[model samples]
Target: MSVQTFKPSVRVGNWNEDISLDEDLLKDFLEKREKGELLLQKSGRLKKCILQKVELSFSKDGFLHFGDVIMLLNPENSEESLSNPSPIYGNYTVSVNPDESALSSKTQLTAPCGISGISNVKPCARNVFIITSVDGSDYGEPLHYGQNFALRTRDGFMGHLYLTSDQKTFLKCCKKSHLQEVSLTDQPSYETCWQFVYLDPQLRMENEGVPVPANTKLLIVHSKTNRCLAVLRKYILWTFFGKECEVTAHTYLNGHKAEENENHWIIVTGNPSDDINTMFDRPKPPSEEMNENKCIVKPLQK
Candidate 1:
């Protein structure tokens, strides 16, 4: 990605009437600057100097920086509406919401509020990310266990990927073991814990009395009587009785369900540091170890 260059047009007038910079004002001011006759300063000390018809430059990452001039708006003025006519010549931060329309750059302006010269744009405290897993088997869709696909957000602020459909099918593929020893009459009791980590813009709980979210993925499996204590110790906290407990789960605060559970769990995150490396370090089995050699041990009867 490359950087964008913009030539800003300047205008000199009592721009306090409206917050917008019309085409006429922009053309007049820019044409003057080209001829080296544009005035940089105003006559009256109390007169407001506002920037109009300005073209903003952005970095490769879509972050806006740099400015030509700035003006301080009267914070006490109630008649001025900053939402409609954002005060020119000042720096402000913008927040991104999960809603698709919130990322639009063209109609970013909203109706004028009571405040003058202030922008309606507010800083975002946290970024919303979603992960959805699809169980292709249930829908007649084959699992692509070893293969994965990637996706991106409209604004380029977020991205993620999951196993290809065919790869999931490979997970279910099986081979017979060579062991001839006598079969154990009884299997140990099944008990394991699983963690469902995801983002919650409102940080609201999915169900009542549930500390985490609802329908969280059950990833861990344990043997009855605690025979497989090694795996149990690693993921013990995610279990309640003899089954996987639902910890923090996905609850898309924007009235959207951001989770998918097709055979495997699909994790989504907006944290700048969240990535494949971070997920790999978690409790889930490595992609390589998910081969046919793995066996599904049943829980022992109580």
Candidate 2:
């Protein structure tokens, strides 16, 4: 194991937008600055400006850092949608439901719909998210257990992730552990904060406050409800993302999540250079531990 240190990236653009400097806007802005039309006030590192694309934050060391731009990928499943032109399955990324196409515009405009307990709320907003520190901690901060963090969307209306009370009547068996829904809010309220629970509660004593490695199996517990973030084999005919699976949040009624792997998630973030569309097909590390060691103890019951 190597100590992977990720130096935070410099960000430009409006709030929550990790500007891809490769855009034409960067060239246009830089040319103006060089021509004396755009003046930059000198700062610690602003004596001279360079225009090149900096990578988005993805952790390299074994742990996921606070500022890493990550995707919450549920484990792969054999299920597929019956109606799609191509196969759509359950190796789904936890994403925000975006604006739908003309055929599906019934999916209302995609933006923060105020708070979570409302009757009408959808959790999935955008595909990608930035793991941010709850207290405005400096960039590249290591995310540790027992610490709170906020998940802010990257591609669209910037909002923090929150648990919703809406019943996804559209989903089958809507009363299961996946019963409760997840959505985004316009502000970072108590509902939007979350804590990471290592599937192996034994790891807690040693790894508390340590950086969590990428690809490790973990439970994302919603701070407000104490329910864990989960995605089932259940697929929804999404207006925008095709037949993507529903990303919901809830703990099991019996308190033992031992029944299924749907409640587990892996942070498959990579270096800015890694492929965004790729997925780790190996068995979920946490599930494997649970099976081999019979580990049902995240304070979880037998």
lDDT by residue (1-302, candidate 1, tens digit) is 97655433343345533435576688889886685444332211111211112121112232111120111111111233344443332221111112222223122222110011122221111111111222222321221211111111112222121101111133321112111111111111111111223233133344222322111221111112211101111111211112221111111122364322211221211112333222212354443333221233444558
- Residue-level lDDT tens digits of model 2 in 168-279: 4566323333366676654566767887777665555676676666766777888777778766544453432235555567664335425246666677654443444322
Q: What is the lDDT of candidate 2?
A: 0.53
lDDT of each: 0.21, 0.53
Clashes of 1: 31
Candidate 2 worst ten-residue window by lDDT: 114-123
Off by over 4 Å in 1: 1-127, 130-265, 269-302
Pairs of residues at least 3 apart in sequence or in different chains that clash in candidate 2: 62-213, 63-212, 96-124, 96-125, 96-126, 97-124, 97-125, 123-182, 123-183
- Superposition TM-score, candidate 1 onto the true structure: 0.15
Give the lDDT of residue 270 in candidate 2. Answer: 49
Who wins the lDDT comparison?
2
